[model samples]
Target: MMSDQPNLVTTCTFKGKEYLVKMNIISGNSLEMSVTDKYTTEEWQCCYDANYIENITHKTGNFKQFDIFTTMLKSGLLKTSECVSLDLLTYDDLEMLRNRRMNGRNLCPSHSVHTNNVNSTSNRRYLILTYSVEFDRIHYPLPMEYCGPPDPQVLQGIIHRLEGEVERLQEQLKKQAEQYPTNNTSHISKLQKRIEDLSAENKTLSEDVRYLNKALSKHSNSMRHIGMMKGIVNSLQEQVIRDRMTSHRQIKRLQEEKAVLKQQHTSSETSCSKCSKDCFSISDSKCLLFTTKFSSLL
Candidate 1:
């Protein structure tokens, strides 16, 4: 029932991208607002495990678990606040909350709820609870105290196993040393040969690795060159299309001009024929004599 406010802020730099986070205050613990791209909320009651709570507390020095739990108890904000107020609440609440819902989830003591889509006005979904430290001190159990070292029986068993392994290794070594003593020149020669073989194998491995790396680099460069070539080809294709369009327009204009010249030539021929006919009617014999003379000259 506490007044809603932004409680915590978190920031992280991931792969050169900067992200900011804001926390919300609600019943007793902070809950992440899922509507934001920056921050994800987790229930405080869910992070009661030793490691989960510690990690968040170490990272965020605000709002400890003890503080939140106590606040929740005093304000009757816990799910079992009525039982808690009467001292009737036992460790079952912790067991149930841990085993049931909040087992693996981590809680941030200084997380924010001020992300977009939180719907702070009508939905009331962005609010989170911040518990009191006193309540946590009283309710949250401490880690199991270690009494001393392991039992003597376990220590004896471990030692026995180790001794057995050592004995077996010693026996094997003795047999090997006896079979190929330092005095045996042939054994030394074989050892040297084995060392040389191993060295050759190592060299081969190194060469393979170097060759693979070179091949990968070459392939990467080839891909880059191919991409560049594709871009150039696309640009050339566009230029070709533009040139074709211009040529098409020129061809159309030339065709129109050719049609106009053909029409003019046909009209001139028709006019000449009419004039010749009109002159022929004035004197058929003269026209006939003129045609004969013209034909003879042709």
Candidate 2:
């Protein structure tokens, strides 16, 4: 919901923490969250990643709008903003607000769904906000895109994850390079098998990189989750440095194999002009085998 007036704070309980989640809008272009834990009175500026938003909105669907999650967003989230305007509440107006509204942005779903006893109602604060958006501009707030600056230290986990993945790929490449393909009777089959292995490794590493990027892209999603991983990240960074050095040695080994293949190709050119066609085929296959391997591993 686009509030014409700036900052708003709402108290909420999520994952056992009672927090005052404050959202402030700076012009039409920015949104920032300042959260204060009620018990400890601690405050932090947070990051809410866009990919995580897609997971919540798509998986939860109407429940996202009808539940406490709805409190954070209008019906359409970053894609669209829709809100209802209501008249000011008189004291008696409070008696019926719950009965009249189902829009997700204004009221928490707990109030909407909790059953009442014979003479009592669920007693919770009813917040009704009236806001508007320009549909043509697509100005809905994207949490990370408009996020407030978070403390720089929050990035440690992401840096660790990236380094880990890069090192893992390097190790895999090093192992492949160790099994040098010689121009023997089994050379063709070995080269083909290595190509397939490298291709599969490339695909897997690419996917891992993409997933890590999504998880680390927003501090809001990672802050609570990353704190518990400090021990894990510390070990990973150390392993990455070792793998990088080993991978450099393996790369030199691959280069020696390439020089051997090129020299073999040169010798074959003059050895038998009668079998020139077969020699050319072998040369092309060997060149392709190494080129494909290097492009993917590097």
Candidate 3:
């Protein structure tokens, strides 16, 4: 027959905290554990294989929380208030046992067994059974005791490991501090050399600017001198054209005076020749009359 109640109910201390632990056997002989925090009222469950109970009873298994609970039970740290026998036998095994007992055959000496009452609390009995069936293997009950605090020696070991880690970190910081000054000095020298080179380049650029300004001033004076020379050449050309026009008018007046004088000279010469001829004729007549008078006187 299957029961709804847990096969074992007990209390245990895990990691310095007290908790209520309940162990149940479900169908197929599987074992389950339910753990609850007494102060916080929080609960959780874990199921183990059927072989886990067998391993625990033999005191040989992978050590985990369940193993710690068993260890605490052996050390009288946890207590059990209710205990019941775990039914490990299958249906076939029970049927075979009944048939053998009915046939009047001698009963197996190994199957005959009884439960042992280990402790009592509040009018309750705690029983642990050891028996064997078809497999001929003996099963032992899980040990239990009253609840208590965790051991002090385990806490001391944790604190010692933490102190060693802190010392190692402090040594690393000291080494970094010792190396900083040498790196800082080399970096400052490189920056000062760069500043000096930039200052020399700036001085050379200032000298070139002064030379260009002097050359531009000389060019401006030369352009003004060329403009003054052009104005003088234009005045000289205008004076030469005025002198040529005066010389042409004087030559034309002298030619007209020479022509008038030549005409007057020709007219005077013609009058003089005619008067001389007339005078000669008058003289010849006077002479002729004188000769005739002389002849008459003779």
Best by lDDT: 2
Cα error of candidate 2 at position 211, Å: 21
Ranking by lDDT: 2, 3, 1
Candidate 2, residue 231: lDDT? 39
RMSD, every candidate, angstroms: 32.6, 19.7, 57.7
lDDT of 3 by residue, 68-107 (tens): 4343333332333122123222233443545665566765
What shift in Å separates residue 79 of candidate 1 from its native position after superposition?
79
Q: What is the TM-score of each candidate against the true structure?
A: 0.22, 0.26, 0.22
* Candidate 3 residue-wise lDDT at 269: 81
> Per-residue lDDT for 44 in model 1?
15
lDDT of 1 by residue, 157-212 (tens): 43344335334433543464456433344433443344343334333323323333
Instruction: Please give the CA lDDT of all the candidate structures.
Output: 0.38, 0.44, 0.41
lDDT of 3 at 156: 31
lDDT of 2 by residue, 16-61 (tens): 6665455654443344455444554344453344444344445433
